[model samples]
Target: MSCQHEESMHLESISQSSTDHSLVVPQCPDDLFVVSQAVKRVKEFYAKHGEIKESHGWNHIQAVCDHTRKALLALDYTIQDNVVVEIQLAALLHDLDDKKYFPNTPPGEYPNASAILKEFGISPEGSRKNSYEKIILMISWVGCSENGNTVPKQVKDTDAYHLLIPRWADRLEAVGSRGVVRCYQYNQEKGLPISSPASPRPQNEEELWAKYATSDKLQEYMDRGGTSKDMISHYYDKLLHIARPPKDIVRNSYLEHQAESSSKDLVEVCLRYGKSGQVDKEYIMSLS
Candidate 1:
């Protein structure tokens, strides 16, 4: 089949399989084929394994993919089709083996992504496969702001921009208006509070993880029968502190501004609500 015809068919298949229609297939035939296959596999995997998570659902995947593409476009360097494919696949399957969803499965194996690539007939020993694994694993480690500051030595030594493109895109998703909603959804699912004025907030990533990372520690908070660290405090402790990209990297200024403004506005409303027991009407209007 002609590449155009194949692209059209894949686009139709993707649309039928997913509610999301925003996926833009790459023009390169090989890239298009791989990415289309990856999208279908991801949908099936998520549906079968975990259905969809509250914050890290299919929607989140789509958003990250979109951000990754845009980030690549904004780059000062030229991106190759193979590199784009690797980055896109990394975005698609970044959370495939997440410990949160598939606890105790294994570490650093990327079994799900590996399986999908195997189905695509990619060689296990190929450099492409190696790059895919590295990028996806790096993305998995790029958590909220507190932890994101520490890039693993191996990742820093690789093609830094290739990995950083997806890492920054994923991190960018954790702030802004979309981010606020995700935080609320996650906290609500966990039965955590919106705010806890009496409790002290975590000072850094270590303390943050110690208090809420493990099942045992999370249960400890649950057993307390009250809010220790509220969902809104998530912004104060982490989201608000998201690092700006260095001068060398082409920053997504629009996203940065939205994150800053939206997060600050949200914290302001939450603080006022705590004291006055009412939503901020003016803030609501400003959003409109």
Candidate 2:
């Protein structure tokens, strides 16, 4: 596959880096420096690599950040300003070194992420430095389940330690309308077909896995001795569970709507043929 590293993301600068921290309604200063710095670094890293996938790219992080803040306001959970900053930072940098984009890289060992954070002076002894690392690791859904890995040192919340607020907030994207779009966009962008009729199988299974296997979720399929050689099987195995009606992990009304609508989107995409629309309409009709 030809990698396009020269395209510019035109990512906006971290403007929220200078807000007033005490303000509770709109934006806060707490995020201005840390979150802004992290966001800046994220875009810079992707700009350098140029092989970004839509599913796990800077845009995805931005959406996660938006959803995180929306969930915070909608839920009205009493969290400190400092903690909110950490959560926001995690949401922004969650996929900096996602396996999907960096197949050979391991979670928690993402050099680009580490370098950027370190560049921003996110040191081990910094107040929220350690907290940021833990939050980032929590987003490692693959690492958490595959090898029984865990972030032992956690945040102050005893009630929602493992299931942290940001954890849910960030994941809000994976199941809703946005998530559905991202899933299909991911396949289209990669030129990977969702089904036989959607696009012809690539001649290189070994190469395909090389890129797709980097995703922690897909890596799990291989780790468990699973034989799902294609991406659509991923939806059958996991993505469908992200939405509501058929499932219900989202706890708030806003997220509930997103999840409900996204599931419908998933079905719509399932019905869609990829680059070429050569689906077996007669067989599809038979199923109905």
Cα lDDT of model 2 by residue, 1-288, tens digit: 111111011111222342422222233444456666666667777677777865667666666666565555545245555555656666666667766677788534766556655666664567657765655565554232232222233333354442343455454566555665665567668766556432222234343334322356434654674334345555544554334322223345555555555555444444453323543334333332
Estimated TM-score for each candidate: 0.69, 0.64
Candidate 1 residue-wise lDDT, 206-288, digit = tens: 55445623334333433453224666555545554453434344245534443445454445545555556554455534542
lDDT of 1 at 177: 57
Q: Look at candidate 2 and give me any clashing residue pairs.
A: 17-32, 19-29, 20-29, 21-29, 99-214, 198-274
lDDT, candidates in the order shown: 0.58, 0.50
Which stretch of 10 consecutive residues in model 1 shows the poorest summed lDDT?
Answer: 212-221
Q: Kindly provide the TM-score of model 2 when superposed on the true structure, using C-alpha atoms.
A: 0.64
Candidate 2 structure lDDT: 0.50
